[model samples]
Target: MKITPGTRSRATLATVAAAGAALLLLTSCASSTEPAPEAGGAVAEDCTPLHEFPTIQDGVLTVAAMNAAPKFHALSDSGPFTGIDATLIPEFAAENCLEVKFKPMTGAAAQLDLREGKSDMFGGLILKTPERAEVFAQSEGSILYETLGFTSAKDDAYATIDSLKGKRIGTLSGSYYVEPLKAAYGADSIEEYQSDSNAFEDLKAGRIDAVAWQSIQGFNFTDRDEDYVTEILGDEPAYPELTVLLENNWPHTKGNTEMTAAIDDYYERAKADGTVARVLTENKIGAQAADLYVNGR
Candidate 1:
């Protein structure tokens, strides 16, 4: 059965709305009347058919995000959230004649917020799995492809999967990497943590031999800590692409085909005009994975 936001209780909606308003006050203190540059190097001038997609709060796009760095959203001490996904919000809101508000959340909670009407959308390096596709509508153009890898404090060679036979490995709980790593190594050889920060802590403290995560994330870690380094894994078989996701049954998405079409068009234009590539380059992430996905090698 297709679940819709209408199935949720009014009390739940009120709670979400109140929480979002509070967060908006705490975050995004700055506002700009001028829109960011779009794919064609021009600002959006009109939001035709704007009445079709109704936001949870009028004139605002509430986003649920995990405050992770590089590819996902990152919260600043006294400024707006900044990252690849967060950076896209201004242009998107401009095109839709809306202001942007960010709500901090992680993992399953972000998905829950979307379903409960706490947020309109969530984007933090989300992968488009078949299971998620059944409930949420993914962006038509991929934000980037993610390659998985292993990070370790030592310079030990990980030339083969067999190299990790008896070593302790850690990964984020509920990540797609868990099963594969467990199958390759034994269940007892792997440890799961609630977040990458926890896993990295174990790795740095020598509790785990390696931390398995996205290659870009691993790179981010190594960039910050000189003692650590990453090894890209599973080159013969590529990892899945990542994209931003919209709640399928939210009020803005319910029967709002035009808004969906406009979003897709924006992404397509961004891809065609090198906006995606430029963003990745500017942030110093996703270049290798992007090349691999585009060139098919």
Candidate 2:
């Protein structure tokens, strides 16, 4: 066949176009490995679902934080994250193939955050009450028993529930402390504060006689915040009637059964592997809280 100028020109054009296409394909392939994710990118089909739990944001577990408390959380919003939750939350997320994020909120707002789909889990000292069970999905008993305490500016600790009859007392509202305090000191007489700081102020100013608080929160009074006198109630042999055997549970949003079961399994595994004990000790919360997990309370 005789070569023509027209045919040769067409062949050259095809060669250049083919060469450019090959270069483009090479560039695309080189950039394809683990593409950079956008900010707040919750769902990524490429991600391996390690725990098989469906998150509000796929591959990301958003934690709704209750206000910073002694031993549970660090004080800052963007955290050094140096507490039991600080350690264990990341550990749970990391090992289970979830990217953990935290949203700082407190009290009723935190629970509402989880319910409203703004976050995935709520890790705090929440009691496993039947009423709460109806609204949220929760981990199995993560704590055995949490003792109650009465905090007063005076050195003396209230020994009996009867001691506070008709006296103005303050405590956190949603906590189990409310009903019990109301029972002893009539509903109208008791005042509830959203944060411990406000309650401490009331107790300090003499507006309230005492603040009924968690025995764990003794860390705040004797150490962290350091002013009040805390009298541990339930542990005393004389007032067994004041004793409350309450279990602290981690509450997730309801209907996330897969996440709930995955978290439950993570708790058992963490307890068995000494993660629970180690984390508790790191935050100086006493290593024995691990027994709560072991006892399955």
Best-performing candidate as measured by TM-score:
2
Q: Which model scores highest in lDDT?
A: 2
Model 2 lDDT tens row, 1-297: 111112210000001111111100100110112222222223333544457777887556788766646534534554433445544665566545566666655667888887787888886556677778888987774633455667775454565677777788888867767876676568988898887778877887889888886655544554333345565543435444346556666788898888777777767766666666655554455333334323523
Question: Which stretches of model 1 miss by more than 4 angstroms?
Answer: 1-52, 76-79, 234-259, 286-290, 293-296
Residue 130, candidate 1: C-alpha displacement in angstroms: 0.8
User: Can you give the lDDT of residue 83 in candidate 1?
Assistant: 58
